[model samples]
Target: MFPRLKVCCISSVEEMRLAVRLGADAVGLVGAMPSGPGVIPDERIADIARAVPPPVMSVLLTSAQSADTIARQADAAGVSAVQIVDRVGPAVYARLRTDLPGRSLWQVVHVTGPEAIAEAERVARHVDAVLLDSGDPTLDTKALGGTGRVHDWRVSRTIRELLDIPVVLAGGLTPGNVADAVRAVGPFGLDVCSGLRTGGALDADKLAAFASAAGVQRLA
Candidate 1:
C-alpha cells in the first residue's frame, strides 16, 4: 500500500480541514511542550480534533511523561491518537493502554544514533506505531519534534525493518526530498510539519506538492 500522509503542527481548525482536503490521512495537534514549535492551547486542540472528519486521524503530540497526565491531556484534546515526544518507561505505556483503551498510542524515537535502534525496539511492543524523528531530548533545553532537520535514513530504515508495527517517518521532510525519504526508509507513513509551512502557516502549494511527492492522490 502507498504510505499515508500526516501533516503536523496544525494550529487551527482551518489548517486541519485543509490538510484533510489535500489528502492528509492524519493531522497532528501539538499540546504543551518544554521546547518545540506549534504548541497550542488544549481548547484549540480539542476544537480541531472535533472538526476533523472520520477516516482522518487527529494525533496529539504531547510531552507529558506520567500516564495519568498523558491520558488526561488526550481526553481533553479529544484526539484519536497520542504521539509521545519524549522517552517514557514501559509502565507508562501499560497504564496508557488501560486508560486510553481504544485510542492509539504512538511513541516517538529520536534517531540520534545507532542506539536508537534498541530504543525503538524496546518501545515497539507497547505502541501501536513508532514515529522516528530527528530531535535530541538530551539537550539542556530539550529539542523535541519540529526541529526541521533530517536524521540518518539508514538508521531509520533499520528500525522500520526491525519493527512489526507501522513506522511513520518525520523530521525535515519536504516536497523536494519526500520521494527520497520514501525510497530510503519506506515508512508506513510520512509526517511533515515545518516543511509544509511557510512563515509558520500551512502552505497549500507546499502541502499539495508534499502529498504528490509521497504518492498521495488528492482526496475527492
Candidate 2:
C-alpha cells in the first residue's frame, strides 16, 4: 500500500471534509501553540474531532510541555490522537502512555542533523509515530511548523530505517515534489499543511493533485 496521507492544520469543518474527500487518512486540527499557523480554540477542535467519522483519525496538534497538561488538553479537545510539537522528556511520554491509554501519541522530530536519528529512535520507543519536520524551535519567534521549507529527506530516510515505528515526513511537501519525497524517504506516511492550501484556505485542486501524486486513490 502507498504511504498514508495526513492533512494537517485543518482550521474548519469544511476543510476537514474536503480533505477527507481528497483521500486523507487523517486530518490534523491544531489546538494551540506558542507560534505557528492553524491555532484553533478548544471548543472548535472538539467540534471538529467529534464531527470526523470513523477510520479517518482526528489529530490534535499541541505544544503543551507536560504529560498531565497534554493529557488534559487532548481529552478536552476530544481528539483521537495528539501530535506533540514541543520537546518533552521521556518521562512525560511514559506518563502519557499510562494516562491516555487508548489515545495515540505522535512526536515531531525537527531534523536538524544526525542527532535527529537518535532522537527519532528514542521517541519511537514511546510514541506511535515520529514525524520528521524542518521547524527550528530555537528561532527568535520559534517556527515549530508551517515554514514551507523542505528538510533533508536523507536524514528522514535514515530515521525511518532506524526506527521500528512509522515515520511521517512533513515540512514543505507539495504535489509537484511528493513523488520524489516518497521515493527518497520511503516514509510510512506524509503530513502536509501549507502545501495543500492557497490564500490560507484548503484548495481542492491542490488536494486532488497531492492525492494523485501520493497514489492515494481512495481514503479507506
Candidate 3:
C-alpha cells in the first residue's frame, strides 16, 4: 500500500548533491535538533530542498511538536515530503496525512525487536509510510541517524510484510550490507546516514558508490 524507500539522510547541501548525483530516491532533512545527530536549522532544510533537483524527494525530519509548523516550512522550501515523529498527534497526522496528498508524510518509529515492531506496525497505520530508526532519543546527533546502530533486519522485514504501506529501513546501513538489506528486508526503500558519510558529512565518492551499488539509480 505504501512505497518502499531508498532514502538518504542528509544535513547539508553537499550531502544533498551527493544523494542526487549518486541516485537517491529521497533525502531526510533534519528540521529541529538539540545537540546530536540531526543538527540542522529550518533554513538549511529549505536550502537543501532547492539544491535537490527534480525527481529527488526531500523528507523533512521534524519532531511531533513542530510537525505542523515544519510542514508549512517544508512546503515553503518546496520539499517533497515531511517525515514526522511518532508522537505526532491524530490532528497533526491527519492534517499532514493529506496536507500534500499524492506526496507523502512518513512516520519514523523506534522498534527494538519483534514485539515492539508489532506494536509499531499497528500504530504505523496512522501515516502514509513507516521508517525504522534507533529507539533512544538521547543518542541522537546532528551527524548521524538510527543511533548509527545496526538494527536487526528482522524488524524491518516483519514490518514490511505486515504493512501494505511502504516501509523505509533506516538504522545503520552501508554499501557492504545494503544489497543484503534490500534483499533481506524486502522493503520499499532503504535509508542511510552515518554509514555513508565521512566526519559527519557526506562523502561524495562514497555516496556515489553506495547509490550505484544500491540499485536506486541517480536521477540526473
Per-residue alpha-carbon lDDT of candidate 3 for residues 154-210, written as tens digits (9 for 90 to 100): 877877888877777877787778788888888777777777778867777777777
lDDT of 2 by residue, 1-220 (tens): 2238999999889999989988997999987777878888899999999989787899989888888899998889888888999789989999998988888899999998888888888888889989999998877877788778899999999899989888899999999999999999999999999998899999999999998998887653
Looking at model 3, residue 191 earns an lDDT score of 78
List TM-score per model, in order: 0.98, 0.96, 0.83
lDDT of each: 0.93, 0.88, 0.69
Comparing 1 and 2 on TM-score, the stronger one: 1
List runs of model 1 lying over 4 Å from the truth.
1-3
Task: State the displacement of the C-alpha of residue 165, model 3, in Å, after optimal TM-score superposition.
Answer: 0.6
- Among all candidates shown, the one with the greatest TM-score: 1
Error of 3 at 4 (Å): 5.8
The better-scoring model by lDDT among 1 and 2 is 1
Better of 1 and 3 by lDDT: 1
Give lDDT tens digits, candidate 1, residues 1-220.
2238889999998998899999998999999888878999999999999999887899999998999999999998898999999999999999999999989999999999999999999999999999999999999999999999999999999999999999999999999999999999999999999999888999999999998889998995
